[model samples]
Target: MSKPFSQACENNKQPILDKLLVHFRQASRVLEIGSGTGQHAVFFAKNLPHLQWHCSDMPANHAGINQWLADYPSANLHAPVPFTIGQDSWPLELVVDKVDAVFSANTTHIMQRSEVPIMFDLIQKNLPEGGIFCQYGPFNVNGDYTSDSNRDFNQYLISQGCGGLWDIADLQVLVSGLDLLHQYALPANNKLLIWQKC
Candidate 1:
């Protein structure tokens, strides 16, 4: 059976890719968090041949990600890895030094606000000096929702027992002590927070 496609993923991949190409030109060993369905992993690894892509997500999503990899296996694309953002012990057995960059898409809005700091701390611990962490999702700014669509989406997320949209300021404050630089605004009202470890 053919793998299912997510319309949102399809619509946003190219735009995300364009931004990645600009920042990831020299990056190697990219760790992708919340690699749902593995479409972005497959596409990015194929396009950015120089970077070794490590796709990861909750254990349940790893099987589907692995299946997606079967169709487009490449030297730079590692097998799907199991990772939970707030877990004390990561499931991966390898003891790598540090990743050059980390990328996550459409995940923050679904995770609790309190968990955000923990996730950032984990990313900081795993990233080497000058490493970049890129997160893509909808965000509120200055305590106000950016769009009506985002407001509705936030409500729906809460209804589904997930965390709603986060404010840019709130996230910035959470990462304030970390060695990070922020980049905001992205296509489709979604924001891309790029942090370069100092």
Candidate 2:
């Protein structure tokens, strides 16, 4: 089977990497949740050679993720372990030791809405003090969409029985042990939010 691809990933990888360079510079290992097509895993690992990028998604996605890794093959990029936010074990020790940073892109609106807070809870609980979590996706600000396209997209996701978009206000409560550090406005109406364990 051919490796999976995401055009969005191809387009935004570089811009995301630029910000990650600064936020994750001191991070030795990063756990990337919902690794989807594995494009970001390879790209980020190659660019940020200092970081050990470990990918995790549901079991069904592991094969496609491995395909990308085989083609690019970076020492810092490891195979994706099975991970379902509210189901599977955190896989923290399964992939690498000491996860100092966590990254997830375009996942907040894709997974079940109920699981969103769980994701935050796990990240904050597992990360050590000063550890960072960077999440990139289209998020609602104060329960409002930033643009018309995002509003339409949210409708589509709801029509398909997905979680639609997560409101920042709702998520703020879930980040108990984390403190908001930076929120960057990126292209395509997406925001890259960074938080640190406090």
Candidate 3:
């Protein structure tokens, strides 16, 4: 099968890696939720060889993700484990023994609002204390859009029946056990929010 591709993933991988190099430097095992097409998994695993990158997503996405992994074939990057945030058990415990960091990109705003909190709850339950969680996406600050493009994107998401841009303050409430560490304004009007498990 051919590899599935995401242009957004290709554009954002490098900048995301620069930050991961710092926040996840001490991490040995990283769990990437919603691995999507697996482009980021391969790119990040190739660049950050020290950390074992485990990709997980719903079963439907696995084939495309695996195809991407097979082409790049990083020793540190593993295949996607079937994970349905609120339904499935944490894949880390089933696949690897543990994970010290968690990463997700462009997932939150597309997920149903109910699933967003569930994802965080699972991260809180499974992520070890002091573990870092990196969430990259467009988000509102204090319930206000940062740019017109993001406002439009939110409308598009809502039209698609997905949850729209979540306010940072609202996310903070959902992420109860994790402390917000850094919020980086990335290119394309997106933001990368880092949190540490308390």
Count of residue pairs whose backbone atoms collide, per candidate: 0, 0, 0
- Estimate the TM-score of every prediction: 0.92, 0.97, 0.96
Please state the error at residue 33 of candidate 1 in Å: 0.6
TM-score of model number 1: 0.92
lDDT of 2 by residue, 12-110 (tens): 999899999999999999999999999999999999999899999998999999999999999999899888988976795743497989999999899
RMSD of each: 1.9, 1.2, 1.3
Candidate 1's displacement at residue 16, Å, is 1.0
How far residue 86's Cα lies from its native spot in candidate 3, in Å, is 2.2
Sort by TM-score, top down from the best: 2, 3, 1
Q: Which stretches of candidate 1 lie over 4 Å from their true place?
A: 88-94, 177-184
Q: How far is candidate 2 from the true structure (C-alpha RMSD, Å)?
A: 1.2
Per-residue accuracy of model 3 over 46-99 as CA lDDT, tens digit each: 999999999999999999999998889988888898998768878745345788
- Residue 184: error of model 2 in Å? 0.4
lDDT of each: 0.81, 0.91, 0.91
Whole-model lDDT, model 2: 0.91
Q: Which ten residues in a row have the lowest lDDT in candidate 2?
A: 88-97
